[model samples]
Target: MCKSRILLVEGRRTVGGGQIMSRRICDVLSTNYDIAVFLPDGESPLAELLQDYSLHRYPMLEYHSGKKGVSDVCRFIYNMWRTCRVLRRFIRKEDITVVYVQAPSLLPVVVCAVAGMDVQIFVHLHVVHVDRKVRLLLNVCLQQKCVKKIIGVSDFTLQQLSLKNRRKSVVLYNYIDDCIKKTVSSDTCEKPVISVIADVMRIKGHHVLFEALQSSALNVEVLIIGRIVEVDYYKELIDKKYSFQYTFTGYVNDVERYLEQTDLVIVPSVGFETFSLAMVESWGKGIPTIASDLGGMKELVENFLPQYAEILLFSPGNIEELKVKIETILNHDILYREVSEKVHEVAYNNFSKTSFRKKLLGII
Candidate 1:
């Protein structure tokens, strides 16, 4: 039997959690399927990451940030139509049997269905909060004949979809690659080093973490890694005075290296997150994480992996509670070590590449 030809569509040009997940999926599925990627026009950081696969570019597929005005809406519709036309041509040219779209974007699903090809369409939902217009678009896309499955990064995300679409929705957790697992460091610093690996956005709760750091009496080193998405917010954070020593490395390539050196990782997201890839990455490196007890972070820590609940979680936006948790992790050595080992065990058993591949292949 011949292998199926799969075309993965990513509508974004920037590097984000969704793009990263798509890259990993492409890397793994390429060995079993004929894989190609349809990305937005212009430079994409994911291109360097997915060097093994064939990349197809189409204009007007780049991500739209912030609120859209009347003109923006008109432009969006025009661009979407152009994108659909390009996608239709590519599907016919490549003879793709499966169309895997990263994130719950309506254009790709609708395009795949309208392309009039005998292909299975799989849409992955990574965020819970969708605009009203996007939600309506998704409903229309779900009704399409080609859309076969809707995969959510977490159960929280799946539940946000319309009830009619829930029947086809499945929860598929993100996985950490072998490179991250193999590079687990057994070393530790003299003072506790807390790291936050996320884009510098207000929703990520970097300001809240900074407040906690200021209030806490413990001596610690903070490493803020990732691109500065919000310039004013990041400026405000840097300008504010805090007792704890910290450094903001604006988007480093070697995330595993930072994870290896850190004593603990913190995910203080105030907004709804589909899944915290940083938490999983930390666990892969045998490091425990202190994440806000909200949305998917709460679901992962409190429900999915309850063993490390007590030490590895804090209420979202609670400065005092966050301070206490940081203090506990820094002051208590035995508890930290125990939680670190347990979380690492859970990550290896469940979130490893092998486990993810098995589950994904079963679904396919």
Candidate 2:
């Protein structure tokens, strides 16, 4: 019997959380489906990661961070038309039955709706909050007959959509990749190593972590592993003096190596997190993480990993509280080991690849 064909659409050119999730979804689905990815035309960082799957290049537009102008509007219109045309042709040529969009994009879903290919559209929402315009667009797309379902990375993300949209939405947590699962835990260092695996942005709360480190007398070495998206903010962070020793490894491909050596992981984000892949991945490796008690991070720890409860979560950007949590872990070895072992067991049982694939198959 022939397998159903799927076209995975990702609009972003750079490697980030959304791209990582998209790649994992493709990897899992490719076993049962004839899967191909549609990416923005250029040297995408995802190209190296998705070498096993077939990729279809298109003249996809990059995400604009600046204010919209008349030229921006014109470009948006042109890109939409171009993308729709390309997708329509690919669907017809490949006889694709399903089109799974990685991040919520209005243009691609609209294209699939009107393409007249008898294809089902699945939009996986990775963002916790979207602007009014994008939210409106998503609502309109969700109403389309061709759009089968809306997948959210977390409950927080699903709640952001309208009530009508919620009926058709489902929450699917991101799973730990095989590479991270293969990581062997190392012995705790003489001076404990704490790891943070988010881009250097203000919203990610790098400054808050530095402040916590400065205020505390804990002797821990910090390992920061991510790209420097905000140059000025990063420069500002590095320029200031701190009490704790830290090293920044900008944009490393393999995060498992750093995760393995560290005694603990910290996710101190001031902004809302849809779902933290870093936290889940670290837990899968039997490592305990101290995350900000906000958004999905709070939900994941409090609800999913309730064993750790109050001990693992701290108020977002609260340096004193964060410092206290870190010190608690560092000061007490028994507490640290107990939390680590329990969290790893829970994560492995709940967030394994086998469980994720089974859930995904049910939806597909």
- TM-scores of the candidates in the order shown: 0.93, 0.93
- Model 2, total clashes: 0
lDDT at 337, model 1: 69
Q: Give the alpha-carbon lDDT of every model.
A: 0.78, 0.80
Model 2, span 224-292: residue lDDT tens? 899999999999999998888999999988888788687888999998898899998888877888999
User: Residue 292 in candidate 2 has what lDDT?
Assistant: 92
Q: In angstroms, what RMSD does candidate 2 have relative to the true structure?
A: 2.4
Judge candidate 1 against the unseen true structure and give its global Cα lDDT, from 0 to 1. 0.78
Candidate 1 on 170-201: residue-level lDDT in tens?
99899988434333222344677889999999
Highest lDDT against the true fold, candidate? 2
Model 1, 179: alpha-carbon shift in Å?
Answer: 8.2
